[model samples]
Structures are given as structure tokens and as C-alpha cells.
Target: MGSGSFSISGSGSGSGSSLVLDGERGELVRAPAVRIGKKGGGKGGLLDEKAMIALRNHSEAERRRRERINSHLSVLRGMISGTDKLDKAALLAEVINHVKLLKTTATEHAKGYTIPSDTDEVTILCEPQPANTTNTSFLIRASICCDDSPELYPELKQSLQNLHARVVRAEISSLSGRVKIVFFIIPERGEGNGEMGRKILVDSVQHALRLALERVNSSMEFIPRDSLLNKRRRVSHFESSSSSS
Candidate 1:
């Protein structure tokens, strides 16, 4: 019949064309006729077995990497919270301390108390008066035990200027071994009145003081070599001047 080769077995129904089976070899003896409607049935067309396995492995690796990054962020959060640095707790404490220091100093002033004269140490001195003045203000006297150098004066001035407070006046006193800075903070009128104005003034001054200290401490932590050299030069100049005198 057909030109294509076919097999005829012993029990062939008709000798036209017949297919044989090979059970032992697990292979088809004759090619099966292609169905006209069948189009895209294939093993290597879409994604093969190896490709699927690779896709699954890549997805799992990405998931694990994201999990690790999240874990690190959590640890940093815990550390910041525990240390109270740059967090809500530190801010609240700063506000509370400001209020307390102001109240104590005011009370002492109202009672005609004399502030202890220990300029070499850190202290808060207050002088209160009746509400007859034009403006409510805080006269802050800050003293610190640091080197006495002309170069430091400008740095100290710059730091105070950065406070953004309404400064009435600033006085710097360079003693034998330390420097003293005094700031008179006058709260602008219409900000508040009566007790509220006093509170606002006190809070503002305290906040400024805190900022100044933070800056000073930061500067002290990493003093530039050039600044240190200038300081030494000043010290030598001072010594020479004293010896000549």
C-alpha cells in the first residue's frame, strides 16, 4: 500500500500496513500518524525541568536576602531606643530639666537668696524682679573649665550665634585658666504674657544652652589639628607675655 514502510505480524488483520510493539525495548516500532488538529505539544518548547528548578532557587535566595536586611534594621532601632539618643525620651528629659532649673532659680531669687560664687564650677544663678519691666528675659551665666585662647573666643561666639535666640547681650570673661560666657535672653513681646511668658523664656534659654553644650562637646571630641596648633601657639604667646611683664 502506502510507500512508507510498515510491519506485518503473524496475526495481521490485513497486509496493507500494521504497527508492531516492542515491550522489552520500551520504544515504538512504527511512527504514529500526526493528528491534524494537534499543534503545540512539546517537552522543550516552554520551560524545561532545569529552568523551573533554577527559577525556584532564585526566588528563595531573594526572599532570604530581604529577611536579613530587615533583621539588621530592627537591631539598629533597638540600640537607638535603648540609648535614648536622638529619641523622644531624650527630648522630654531635656524639657523637664529646663523647667525644673528655671523654677528653682526663680524661687531662690524671689526669696532674696545669694547665688553661690563658684565660677570655676557649673552653676545656674537667677535674679527675679516684679513684672514691671518692658520685657521678660533670662540672664544666663555660663562658665566652663577650658583653655584660655584668643582663637577659642570666635568659636564660642559662633556657637552662641547658631543658637538662634534673641540675645540682649553677651559678655565673655577670660580668667586665668577658664572662660565664662553670659547671655541675656529677652523673649520677644507678644510671644506670651504673665507666667506663660516667663515659662517660654526659661524654656527657650534652656534649649539654647543644651544646643550649645552639644556643639561644644562635639567640638571637643574631634578638635582639628589646626585648631589645636593655634591653641598651643596662643599658650606660648601668653607665657611669653607674662614672663616679659
Candidate 2:
């Protein structure tokens, strides 16, 4: 046999392998490259089958939400008046104003008072002083009617007084609970008799009437001022039983 030498050598078994010293490992081997097609992008890129399904689901949900919102708006538009026009923005504005008016009406009638449908219960009229008359004054006539009570005269008088109004003449009459009053008034001293004055005076009286109604509905007492107390003016009162009395 030939003489064998004790030597250290490393070699791989194939052409692709590396050589190294015996008992020592070779260089690190890299993993093979995985080839991918152009169509197969990442999760955020080209949509796969599962991503397409998810996208369709989201789109459908958004469509349903929009449909629900439109349905509600349609119902609101139907309930409001004067919305026959095709303008959506104008219709929405009308709805807002209508809602405000409804709320005011509801609050005004909260005490079981229903506004009359066929009758005029309140009237405000302003007329210029007669040309022949020497005095420069405008006549403001206001009439209000409700279920008359013994306190109605004092309430009306107090309201007029609060506005510093001078009532030239007033007539009060009642049948059952129906009380009616006609007031002929002029503005206080130094106030104008023009459109501005009339508007202010009318608004004042209207606000006072509203407050009086609230007080009456709640059974609150009306205490006349000391000046009004001494100027005791008798108001005509009528009862249904008066016919027999």
C-alpha cells in the first residue's frame, strides 16, 4: 500500500459547492430567489380576490348609508310646506324656518289654548289723525278677546301702562267666558306717530298679551300699581246667567 499522509482538506461534492479546511464549515449559503409574476403585487397594491371582495363590501355599505340619509331628508321635506320647488338648498331652509314657527306655536299653546281657526281673536290697526283735527296724532286700535275673567281689565291696563301708552277710549264686554276689548290709544309724550312708532307700540302690546296669557294659564295673580289702584275704573262684565238675573 502507498504511504498515506495525515492532511486537512475541504471540498464540496458538486460543482456548485465550496472548498474549505477539513473540520471547518464553508461560507454561508444563500437561499434561492423566488420568482414572482408582475400581476401579483402586495396587499396595498393590485387587489387580489379577497381584497376585491372587501372593497365591494365597503362600497355597498357606503351606498346603503347614503340611501338612509336621503330617505330621512325626503320625509322631512314632505312634512314641510312650500317645498314644491326643485331646489334642495331652498327646501332645507324652509324646513328650518317652519320648524322654528312650529316650536313657537307649540310653546304659546302649551296651556290648553288652541288658536281659533275660523275667527280673528286679535287685531292691531294704526290710522293717522284726521286732517281736520289740530292735534298731530295717530290712532292705534287694538282688540283682543279671550275667555274673560274679572282680572282681564287690570291685566290689559297693566300691559298698556307698561308701554307708556295713553288709552283714549276702551270698551270691555263679555259673554260667558268670552271677553272682548277695544282700545283706542295714542303714543306717549315725545314718541313719534310714524310707522316706526306704530311698529314699536304694536310689538310691545303683543309681547305683553303673551305674558298675560302665560300668567293667566298658570293662575298667577295680577297686582296693579299704586297709581292704577287709585284710578278705579269699572269694566263691564257679562255672564251667561245674566239673561235670567
Scored by TM-score, the top model is: 2
Displacement of the residue 36 alpha carbon in candidate 2, Å = 99
For residue 16, give model 1's deviation from the true position in Å.
99
Candidate 1 per-residue lDDT over residues 108-222, each given as its tens digit? 7756322223243433444563467534434434433344445455555565555433555544444344455555544454543567665555565555555555555566656
Error of 1 at 176 (Å): 4.3
Which regions of candidate 1 deviate over 4 angstroms?
Answer: 1-126, 129-133, 137-165, 224-245
lDDT of candidates 1 onward, in order: 0.46, 0.56
Q: List the candidates' TM-scores in order.
A: 0.33, 0.39
Worst 10 residues of 2 by lDDT: 1-10
Expressed as tens digits, the lDDT of each residue in 1-245 for candidate 2 is 11111123333332122221211122332222222324645543333335435544554666667678778778876887557664767777888888899899988875443222323266778777886752446777777766545566577667777885666666565443455576676666666556786788877766776666555545524443443234333445332111111
Best by lDDT: 2
**What C-alpha lDDT does candidate 1 achieve relative to the native structure?**
0.46
